[model samples]
Target chain A: MRLILRQRELVADAWRYAGEEAGADAPLIATLAELRTDPERHLARRGALGVRLTPVDRVEELATHLPRLALVACEFPGPGEGRGYSQGRLLRERYGFAGELRAVGAGVKQDLVFHLARCGFDALELAPGEDPAAAVRAWQRYEVGYQPGAAQVVLRRQRFFAATPPA
Target chain B: MYQYDELDQALVDARVAEFRDQTRRHLAGELSEEEFRPLRLRNGLYIQRHAPMLRIAIPYGLLSARQLHTLAAVARRYDRGYGHFTTRQNLQLNWPRLEDVPEILAQLATVQMHSIQTSGNCIRNVTADHLAGVAADEVDDPRPYCEIIRQWSSVHPEFTYLPRKFKIAVTGSPADRAASEVHDVGLHLVRDAQGQLGFTVLVGGGLGRMPIIGQVIREFLPVADLLSYLEAILRIYNRQGRRDNIHRARIKVLVKALGIERFRDLVEAEWQENRPHHVQLPQAEVERVRAFFRPQPYEILADLPAPAGNARLQAWYRYNTHAHKVPGYRAVFVSLKAHGEVPGDMSAEQMDALAEIARRYSFGLVRVTHTQNLLLADVRQRDLEALWRELEALRLATPNIGTLTDMIACPGLDFCSLANAGTLDVARQIQQRFDDLDYLYDLGEIEIKMSGCMNACGHHHVGHIGILGVDKHGEEWYQITLGGSASGVTALGEVIGPSVRKNEVAATIERIVEVYRGVRADGERFLDTVRRLGIKPFKEQAYAPHPAAA
Candidate 1:
């Protein structure tokens, strides 16, 4: 029954996170601790399995289990806490995580939408009181950036041509 | 100087539009103060004591005359009629309103400048040697690399929000004018054994409550791997650094906790594992950026003789001008530390006039030093006299570039909400006490850097004479440190004695100088004397019962 912005579209989330009662038809997103304890047990669940990663959770531990996973949710406790960004990047680029890379927790807001997307978060589950339409509009804040990111095509690639001669 | 391309302009324009929308939302009460604080801070807007302070980035200290004029206009039109040049080679407008910042930023974008990442927990402006291209003892210019780093760090997706604010400095010369060792990351341009250009990378050096010198992480990082190596290091810091406590969150604390060797190993491992995905510096891009820093054309001419002028002019020439690699040119320092005035405050009128003067003499460009002064790096020797006379008329020629009165001070309690004491008045008292130029010349090259708090915004840790302000029971007191030096054996000063009363700070300094004068060896500088004799004599003299007390 929760709503999230997935690939620039606001849609109802069918995945349930930890602490919530697992629905009969909903895919359960378990914590990294749960998945690490008995990977096969979680892997053999009724529906597709997802893993939620805290800031301190190592991405390399989940690499071998990435292919069987349906989603990877990186949690940000607050806005100033930024370890999730590195987690998102490592999951996609280092571990080749092709599943839905989702950003969750209290820190996900409109201000962080562009950065989260740039760091390879294909879906963003913002905190309470955040506007989804404004978060979608945040993607247009920058058409180009200087560094190559997870979705790398938006970077300004051409060599700098000065408008005036150098001194 | 590097000029902005169409792409650069577009990014800046987009940023202005985005900030405008963000500000509108915040004003309409949609965003709470806590939610909007980080967003505004990343754009260099700070809610200071009096008003919002906007810090504009001056990348590698280089500025075109036209850009300077725009800054003057911004100062004149938006806020106060003046701005403060900080120790990081950035300009801060002390009284800008939050509502007006968007419009101010839009105006600044017209001239290819923005205040992006000048504050907050993101990577701040990339700083470098002020005398980048024209210094006599240079390996290579550091500006191009600084620019490359600037672009890579600008709104970096992963590293935008970190444990704490980060600073990086690059220096090319052996003299280390950029103070790279005291930064979060210091990049030194050096040549490998086979004569290939690379960087000697240092990590975790910072000046705050706990000041620590940066440790060398890599002796020689190839030019091609600059961005990748940086990315690896940043990734390690962003992931492993302590975020539980804000005070213990700097990379320095992490480096200290894990030990430099362990930290370096982690960085190296991360770097190796992600080599393919790491951002690599392309040779073509390096060349493209380097082309913008090509040396200005110089005429074939011999060095001229000393100009016949008044004693003030001669003194100005001796103290305020520096040697240039080119024979006929000299790099001139426009002293912002004029006695009895605030250290780095410059009026809009002065900025506009300086822009015109720079256009006439120094190829329409200026450089702001980390010591909070301006420089015309390409002035001809033949033009020194005329330039000095004009500078004298404008009150910019103080003839006290390296003396005791030439201090580095933060805005302190007057403008900073976080300050514990007022530093500008202390600066004025010290200036008034040491009014004699002859006495200042005798005790040559004593750097007095003062900060109103432990934040160390004034870089008091690396000064030869560091003064830190502390509050005790609703009263101001100053703690003095000695023997710190930023260049040629960089060090942090040691505490000399107990805190002195606010009014007695200058007298305490006078006592320390007297001890130096009594005990110094022949031709030794103040720092040399302190290093040789240690702070024992200075401390004894500083704490001895005063005549008035007796």
Candidate 2:
């Protein structure tokens, strides 16, 4: 039942990379620095690896960088900080990077999964022994938005004023 | 009274939806407090000292019976069963909860009303003469132009976030009932030498910390260029108006600092650069808006009936009513500034009653005045008695309009979080002391204005006898000023002497009136006498220490 996530995986691999003598089969995860800066270093050489990035770390930077790297991870540093959500949007919309943008750290609340998904975060890392099924159900609460988003049924209004001349 | 076309309606509906979403996000913690603050303020929702206050726009003080009723409903349902009408010709509802604001705005939208641009550092509700259409001296109805400006300024992209709030007042009549000289941008609808209707544009006049009379920047701005010219002035202010200090942020302060000539040059340069791109006003559009406010059908009658035995009605008619342009019709004023009542207050029942009267006697139109009074225009001479009877029953037929008791006061210490002293109580005390209407009519046109602070929200500086409340050593003290006027040839009121304690204000006003009565030389109004004798005579009488009696 002890499934290794991004932050824990990165800490476990860093311990292994430093030649520690603990559990050898414990999965490894890459740090936010691995995703944000010098991604090739972690992508080219790793075992059971995951990447972690804070919301403040520019998401536009990952649009080009995420595709070359095999594994990518994103982190929400604290509650109510939304830079990560926008970073996820750039990753989904512009670059078309489909790899997992994992929601990690204390910022992973069940209520935010829908927003994270809208911003193209498909996978989430919760605290130890937390259920992901309940977290996934939180995204289905609101069915409509006046604004267009990643959710289906993106409504666009086109106004036709009789007085306006054709462009 | 311009009816919203589909475009206008769509715009308002979209804006309401947008604001609702913003409110939802703020409440649900999707938006931070800092991000939500400006959005709510732009929508006219303010977090006041007691509760959330919502200000509804009443563009140029014109409202239909239906609109007024909608306001009443909103007040009764969302607020504390009452609303306060402001000097800017808008209504403010106190005690609306933060969560209920979207619902309130939705209700307002149904009546073609929204609180947009009411509170922000943007172009505010345009005010005009309350008697625009019916006044005898008016050149044309200013409502059409006011409506045009209202649309142009509402949530304007370039000018919505200015250095400070801006106000524009328009006056079609030479009498200047709208107080054009005290607004940020004052437009006087005038006829040039060739008999063309255009605006004599004045800039930088305002009443806040530094009171000033606006200077004429353009002698005669062509009627067609009204919007373009206004855009020019706003652009100049937005780019150059001081933002570093809040006190010096107003256009009036900037105009003063740069000097009128320099400011005019700057605006003219801006006008030159931006004139070509502005949206031209079409004649059809003007006619379309004007059609909504066409003159009500008035009957031709020879004369007004002689004063009857109902002395109360006669007193009310003489003091509260004004001459109408139509031969037989009269412009009747309903005094909301009666003693002990808050200024510009009407209960839901009272609102319905007034609506009934407007439908019955005055072509279904009502006007809220800058002086916190209401008007029923185009009332026939024969229907005066019936109208008076109905109004009297509603407790609105107060005979003290433009008298000492009909005081133009702000929501002082009671409601306004910024006020330093209690103005409503002072107004009540003065009204109780000067209860005799016959004596008041004899006193003749004494305008008493009270503001709780130096910000001049009550426009105390323009009153005939101005009362400014100051917090002196943890107690309320009032300063008196004489000879200020907002009408035809505007002038700021002069302070007679030092500030007096709040308790002694009634005595001071009485003494000042006595001085005027004693010095008058046949057929002179209070303002005229004060103008003739200067402030010296009134000062000596007001400040003279009571003689020690033997």
Candidate 3:
């Protein structure tokens, strides 16, 4: 049982990632490789389905299976590894993923929580020893952003620089 | 010159508070140095050879007098008594304590300044032409577009942790004073066939171990599509660039490996996909930012005659001043490369004095040039003599701009951890050897750019006479290159011969220049001579055994 920031709340993670022993009743986050190896087998799994993505994994491979997937976990391998950000954006904006999007792996430090959320990750599985409270606080650090992000924090402020287009 | 509105102010303030907490966490041992390095670097804090260096962004090199004063005060209060202006048009405080940076950033924010994305693998400070608004042969000012890009790139979630650092440079004038051709992405402000404003986009140009000139990706990109198009390019580079190796990670390497056509196709596809999702840059916002750069309220005075003065005054007026687009104004260069001083290093006292002088003469504004000089971009022509006297008293009027001694050098082994050798001493050697102004005038516009390593912080690859310091076993050696220019005909310099001893660098330059003097046609600059006669003549003279040794 690990504490995770889900939609800006501290919650116990129920989804088990790769290399973890779990029962068939446990909601499992399978690897993209596993899904690609036996697509029909993994997609037809009982309970809620999820798929884990690495930095090099193509999100388009899971495009057709988005409706069946309930969780998409993008893994960051190490520092300065950013390909997962694009994966998160593609899963949300391009593929219109409706399930939970989680940022997980060694690079998921508290400092990156806001950026991960902005890239549309609703759940952040932060790195080991990172303060969960601080990770949750990072989401509300800035109430504004220059771009129209997927999980943008600002709700009331003017999103665009100009209220209306010039005449 | 753009003023920060409430939203901009709020963002910077929040950033300061966020960094404060990050610093607290690190100091409390909750964050390790390995985890904090990238975090601190993105905020412009670097653990240098001696101490932490905090680089404060002077966006596009424009600074208000108030901001300049605040920088001076910060330098006086926090670290050493001086600061170094980098080649990227940012100021680096060499000796700030890590514990004091958060407060330093707080002090800077009071005057609408921050160090966001100044370093690390993110979009660096967006640079534009130093003479943005006042250059005589100009199109639209590039600063507004630079500001727009700056806002978009600051803390940008997707692109902050790219494969490597990204730089974007914009130039409005056709002269290309900003060296946009050598940047990661270069934007040239241009008018389309229909009189609409747009950009001639160039991609993949960078200076490092493998220097390459950027290729034109778009003939004309409409003004409205700037951000979306840039986002497309960044997304392509981030997802596809080589991340295994640091040396091969720049966008230039990606462009070379994939070829510009394939890269452009990918970027075009990505741009099309992201265009509808992006908040389009509005015409009102463009006008809003452009309004900040409008012409100053100039007096109704006619052009004054050149003042009757001594030879030094005549030379200062000739070399240190540029033509302003307005009738009665001139852009003045405050020479930071004075003889016997480190290039681009300014004292706090000098900063305070210059701020006062700028307030008096240049509409309370100052600009930093890529060549490591401060500029008063809107000085009155009538105030030339008085300004010259004030600058001369402060040793800021060296009257050697665009000369061989007016070199660009980085903080080499003396301060930088990545440097292979020291550059300031070599810069001093060259300055002392070529002390004769008459000979420098005779040489005419030879850019001697020196870098301590191949990281190319000083942009040595594009200099007419490029000097790169090499670590030979334990001693320092110098490699010389010829005929690189960052202007309209942008090209990389070719190495002349094997590296010389560190002491022989100045002599090598002397031999090269003597050869140039002998073979140069009438009115030919050193670069023109090197281009016409080739590096063979200079190489023969430069590597020739010294007469003293013989």
Q: Quick one: best DockQ, which candidate?
A: 3
Q: Per-residue lDDT tens digits of candidate 1, residues B1-550?
A: 7888877888889889988988998999988888889899999999999899999999988989999999999999997899999999999999988999999999999988999999999898999999899997888999999999998888888999899999999999889999999999999999999999999999999999999999999999999899888988889999888888989989999999999999999999998888658676778989999999999988777998777769998989989999889989999999998887899999999999999999999999999999999999999999999999999988999989989998999999999999998899999999999999999989998999999999999889999999999999989899999998888788999999789998999999999999999988898999999999999989988975968999
Relative to the unseen true structure, what is the C-alpha lDDT of residue B345 in candidate 3, on a scale of 0 to 100? 95
Listed in order, the DockQ scores are 0.40, 0.03, 0.46
- Scored against the native two-chain complex, candidate 2 gets a DockQ of 0.03
lDDT of 2 by residue, A84-147 (tens): 6545544554455655556666656544554565556666666443455545545543333211
Per-model chain A TM: 0.87, 0.63, 0.89
lDDT of 3 by residue, B60-96 (tens): 9999989999999999999788999988999999999
Q: TM-score of chain B, candidate 3?
A: 0.99
Off by over 4 Å in 2: A1-167, B544-550
lDDT of candidate 2? 0.75
Superposed on all Cα atoms, model 3 deviates from the true structure by an RMSD in Å of 2.3
Instruction: For model 3 chain B, give the 10-residue run with minimal summed lDDT.
Output: B271-280
Instruction: Write the number of the candidate with greater lDDT, choosing between 1 and 2.
Output: 1
Alpha carbon deviation, residue B416, candidate 3 (Å): 0.5
- For each candidate in turn, the TM-score is 0.97, 0.77, 0.97
Give lDDT tens digits, candidate 2, residues B1-550: 6888765666677678767877887899866676566567778887776887888888888888888888888788887777887787888888898888888888888889899888867788899999999887888899999988887776453455577889999999888899999999999999999999899999999886788899999999878788878877886776567766878988998899899999999889867754434546666767888898888766767667745888888887787788888887888998787667887777777887888889888888888899888899778887888889999898899888888777788888777778789898888778777877667887988898889998898899999999999998889899999998989778899988899988889888988999998998788999999999899999988964756741
